[model samples]
Target: MTTHALVLKTFPAGSPRGSWPAEEFAARLREHGRGAEVVMDLVADSFLVVEAAPPPAPQDTSGHEASRLGAVA
Candidate 1:
């Protein structure tokens, strides 16, 4: 399987001020069809490493319900 890496800088998005939760970020990636692994530093306030699962084979999107949602880019 192929893998990809990403570097992320975290910041508060909603609610109270604090660093973004790693698990929540991971979950979002999973929802988008990518698996995520996060690495953090003790001193730094930002995240460093993220490894993601390979993208799945493309599926036909024509006539799918999601297509009607809106134009994707």
Candidate 2:
């Protein structure tokens, strides 16, 4: 997990893309303190701001359950 893309501002052609929600675009970038879930406008009027990375530490499986409970060594 680790996504970052700042550019939440820039509209002109066909304007109508400012439904801020994701914590107000992460508070317009407050040193990236919060915000998770936002991916609107990209390229034309740039408007992407997402920062969610902190949930990937749970894969031990206890050594596959000790080899299916066949532990020995």
Candidate 3:
């Protein structure tokens, strides 16, 4: 499974309804180029915005750097 982290939170305008519309919020994320999935955090009682998965870590294949640094591990 992939882990997603919170990126943004937008509270209801005017009257605080204590929650945001899930669909609208998700759509908003898409519109804003976030394009992530939405999850409701019961503990915080707020919409938890998160991407489907975390980005992949960068890879280094060149052994030159490791050799130069004398990294044995």
Per-candidate local distance difference test: 0.57, 0.50, 0.61
Query: How does candidate 3 fare on TM-score?
Result: 0.43
State the lDDT of candidate 2 residue by residue for 1-73, as single tens digits: 4544444444333434655444464675655645444455646554445555555655555554444566535
lDDT of 2 at 5: 49
TM-score of 1: 0.38
What's the candidate order when arranged by decreasing TM-score?
3, 1, 2
- The count of residue-pair clashes in candidate 3 stands at 0
Stronger candidate by lDDT (2 vs 3): 3
Taking all chains together, the TM-score of candidate 2 against the true structure is 0.28
Question: Tens digits of per-residue lDDT for model 3 on 4-61?
Answer: 4755654333334664466577787798888667666666655655665566765556
lDDT of prediction 2: 0.50
Candidate 3: where are CA atoms >4 Å away? 10-22, 56-73
Native-vs-model 3 lDDT? 0.61
| All-Cα superposition RMSD per candidate | 11.6, 8.0, 6.2
How big is the positional error of residue 73 in model 3, measured in Å on the Cα after superposition? Answer: 11
Best by TM-score: 3
